[model samples]
Target: MQQPPPPIFPIFRSRITCAVLTHTYVGDKEHSITALAAATGTDSGTMAREVSRLERAGILASRHVGRTKLVRANHAAPFYGPLRDLVTIILGPAQVLSEELADVEGIEEAAIFGSWAARIHGESGPTPVDIDLLIIGRPDRDDLYDAAARAKSRLGREVNAVVVTRSRWEANKDGFIRELHSRPVVAVPLPHGNAA
Candidate 1:
């Protein structure tokens, strides 16, 4: 079998760690560990342990409210700003896209292609200045633009979405399309609740 592709960012011990930190740092003000676990497809016990580890690192802070434990990035930590920025730059685009496009209709497949995806797949290059989202299948035009706008705002980077027909994508009739097919592409995830 072909060896798995190297991780985009190997700083985190696991993808789950990156996911946990990304959600906590970039998504909301606070989250319940149970909710975070469910969101990241991790078990609750493991999520709790991960949270505790982050808390010990001072990268996360938690408050226990009766039986509810709420977790959030520790803004008070000295390294919080850099740490947050790091995760945001690395994983924020995918997270933002999923959130914005979750309700968008008729998306058969979606992904990040071009430079951002290239960087994620371990290619050495300058930091990507924008995100290229390839959307296959017909989706509502206005809704797609609206979602891209919101994602751009959150990412602090431009998001350029190209609508491609399923037939065009599958046939790969041109140099550009074939080039995309040859490169590393990061699949844009559907929201957990909406995954088919």
Candidate 2:
């Protein structure tokens, strides 16, 4: 199973293809329903339904190994390349960010809080051109920024990061923090098996 980076992706208003597809497309890896659920912040039932729909449409292919069914993008599907390219171009941020942040140390929690987050929350608007990241913990500034720089390079979007101590994050009752709490904040999951 591939490591997960975020809890969800409300991209394109479809939790269907946006998150799950990008992940399977990444590394051309096969994924089980459980893995897909974890990757997309969804339950197995949801993933199973979506997977069945995509499979019927020939957009995805799957087979069972005993009781575990493994799924992946159907390379044989028509227009597969173009569709993969399109999704990766438009919805690649989550996967890219996940890979970039997986090894960064000192972050107790990380999340996206801005236009992108708004879009993920189903708000109607123009597509966001940047990523607004909030890091709570004392991670190395240089490492964090460097990872952001690399992500920007890969994503063709600027990544702006704000750092706040966990104490301040818990204690500060400022407008900025209030606004963040009021809005839809997309929580980025920490790398699996990494000690927080």
Candidate 3:
């Protein structure tokens, strides 16, 4: 069977848009155009243009702070509720998790499972409070826990991770592992040269 198309927010395709949204909503900070540009890794000119567009569309609001223009999400905008929900529950988590796990070692594969996975797979219900992670290799437990803690603070949600050796994962003899692999999981892509 063919898979469904991925969720697309046209604005989110732009670096400036993601950066602006990240700061105002996810990062919970107001940012100047230059600052947002730096944060988003886009040229200041491009960031300024995008911020202008968003401001005019009522998605973001800007005000002068001394000589600098500070911009923030317009919570009163009609699109705010749904857009924030989409960014918060969907776009943000994937990006956040990827960054958090990118430097970790000895992970052959990692995936998000449980309710968050269910929702991403189109099963809808209340958004899950915590993120469930399955690591398919034996990574440093202390380091993994530290990364999970930082990720939790950054994502504003708890992260639960389970690490199993390659042998255990390949065998798939455990009922929990069987069930975990049986469900739809959002794969967490590893960084270049990273084993997982």
Output the number of the TM-score-best candidate: 2
TM-score of 3: 0.59
Candidate 3: worst-modelled 10 consecutive residues by lDDT = 1-10
* Candidates arranged by TM-score, highest first: 2, 1, 3
Which digits, one per residue and each the tens of the lDDT, describe model 1 over residues 95-191? Answer: 7797899988878888999888886676877778899999988888898999999898878889999998889999998888998899989888885
Model 1, residue pairs in steric clash: none
Global lDDT scores for all candidate models: 0.83, 0.77, 0.75
Total clashing residue pairs per candidate? 0, 0, 0
Q: How much does each candidate deviate from the true structure in C-alpha RMSD?
A: 4.7, 5.3, 8.1
Residue-level lDDT for 87 in candidate 3: 73
What is candidate 2's lDDT per residue for 62-168, written digit by digit as tens?
Answer: 99999999998899998788777666655666667767888888888888888878766667677788889988888888989999998888767899999888888
Instruction: Name model 1 segments beyond 4 Å from true.
Output: 1-17, 29-50, 62-72, 75-86, 192-196
Q: For residue 185, give model 2's deviation from the true position in Å.
A: 1.0
